[model samples]
Target: MAFNYEQYLRPGKLPHIWCPGCGHGIVLKGLLRAMDACHLDKDRTAVVSGIGCASRLPGYVDFNTLHTAHGRAAAFATGIKLARPEMTVLVVGGDGDGVAIGGNHFIHACRRNIDMTYVLCNNYIYGMTGGQFSPCTPMGDKASTTPYGNPDPTFDIAKLAIGAGATFVARTTAFHATQIDKLIAEGIRHKGMSVIEVLDDCPTAFGRRNKFRSVVEMMKRFKETAVPAATAAKMSAEELQGKIVTGILHREERPEYCEQYQQVIDRARGA
Candidate 1:
């Protein structure tokens, strides 16, 4: 049977703002499927996003949604988790919004081991904001601001999440459409901070400037370059260059932030 995505989507919100061939819609469907698999009550789930092309996702979903300032999605979601720890809070945004501007908030949230899910949609370049180069852009990619080729180093978001103490971390590309929902559903079920990075394509902004002829070409690259985590482990470091290791990269048990905060309250009452 076909999944009834319409039940989770807002009526009259069709015709999203993403450009033709954009993969954000694919990721959105995966998210909705994950929510359904988890049996999450729409009223109890809060979806938050910052300013960016990916951040506009919450506007189309039927849930408690927050369209916040640029690069502040993690921070805003943290507050929501602290105030109502029982509610399922999810943060969604692009690479630039999550790491460049919201880097501090993102790291702290991970460090605290907050019980929330962060879905980072990485399209390499700043797709909406003038095709600017972002932290995740390839070292030598072309963008509006990097016509001469980007010189900055790229960030490994999954590695960053693991190092910063996220209890659950996973990565999947848009090409692996089926895996997106599975990873997201696992993240939602996890007890601590969960970061799922989705490598999607922005054909209009990132692809054209980088010389990708079409969306299919971009997706082909993902299919060729992605390595499953199990297979990646047996490969040599040299063999793994330029390869993205998808699947759950890291996961560990930890004390969730809200639960720890409640301990403080209990202690204070006893004092």
Candidate 2:
């Protein structure tokens, strides 16, 4: 039986604009499924995105969606969650949008430990604005800007989120569809800031330049190399080299930003 995603999607948006082999659609689908899994009130959920291929997600979803400026989805989500603490705020964006231009906001959001979620679609390259080497682009990877190869070391997105003080952090690839939904659902249930890094594919731009023969090859690579966090812990660094770590990396209870601020206001009121 086909899973009907029409209810979550906006009307008259039947045909999405994503490319044939793009994995952003799958990430969005997993997010919606996670929303359902948590039994969230759709009316009270707000989705925000920055300018990029993955950022276009909010426009097609039926929710309080904001298509914001480039690399500002985290900032927008922080504001929305603060203004309406009852609402569930979710920020979606690509690697370029989240870590390149928006790195400041991203780190600070995690530092704040706000009651919100950030779903980062790390496709390695800047897919929409031609294939540019993003902050997450692996060393020696080819992009339009890096004809010879990208020399800069890649950012481990999950580690960055943890280092920045996110209460909850997880990583998964497009191949791990069920894991994506499971992690996002858990993130939503957690009270503090959560970062879910989804290593997705952008076949048209990233794939062609990186020498991926086909979408199948790209997906097969993920299946072979993605290691669970628990398993990775036992393996030596040399043994786990070139492997993508999946599963929840860090999680801890924290006084969410809004609640802490509210307490200060109440104390000042002397009531």
Candidate 3:
């Protein structure tokens, strides 16, 4: 049976503008499935994104949505959730928008333990603004700006989120459709800040210059590099050196910022 995305997808938004081999569509599909599984009310949900090719997601979804400024999705989502604490808010954007340009907001949001979900589509390169090396871009990966090789080390998004105080943190790849959907659903169900780093394919900008050969080759590389947490635990640091750790890295209860702030306000009024 074909899973109809029509209900989640806005009418007249068909034939999404993403590149042929781009994995944003795949991630969107997974997100939709997760939403369906969670049985979340679209009317009560808000999807927000920043400026980027991946940030175009909010326009295609049928929900209270926002297309915000570059690298400010987290900030915008934070405001929305605080003002309307009853609503379910989800922030979607690419690696550059969330990590590079929006790095500070991302950390603060996590630290506050906001009641929101962050979907970070990490294609390694800045797909919208040409292929520039992003924070998640591998140490030696080549982008348009890094023709020879990237000198700096890459950011581990899952570790960053966990360290920054995300109540739930998961990592999955576009090729792992089922796992991606499950993680997103779990993230949505969690009360405090949740971050799901989705490793995706940027065939045009990143793939072409990086010598990935083809989209299949890149996906194959992801599959080869990814290992489950249970399996990874058995392996030594040297053995798991360059592998992508997939699955829920961390999940725990935390006090949401809005609730804490409300309590402070109530106490002040009582005093």
Off-target runs (Cα >4 Å) in candidate 1 are: none
For residues 100-182, write the lDDT of model 2, one tens digit per residue: 89999999999999989899999998988888999999999899888899999888888898999999999999989889999
lDDT of 3 by residue, 20-52 (tens): 989999899999999999898999999999989
Candidate 3 segments exceeding 4 Å error: none
List, residue by residue over 30-144, the lDDT tens digit for candidate 1. 9999999999999899999999999999999999999999999999999999999999999999999999999999999999999999999999978887799999999899989
The per-model lDDT (C-alpha) reads 0.95, 0.92, 0.93
Highest lDDT among the candidates is held by which one?
Answer: 1
In model 3, pairs of residues that clash are: none
Using lDDT as the yardstick, the better of models 2 and 3 is: 3
Sort every candidate by lDDT, greatest first. Answer: 1, 3, 2
Of candidate 1, the 10-residue stretch with the lowest lDDT total is: 124-133
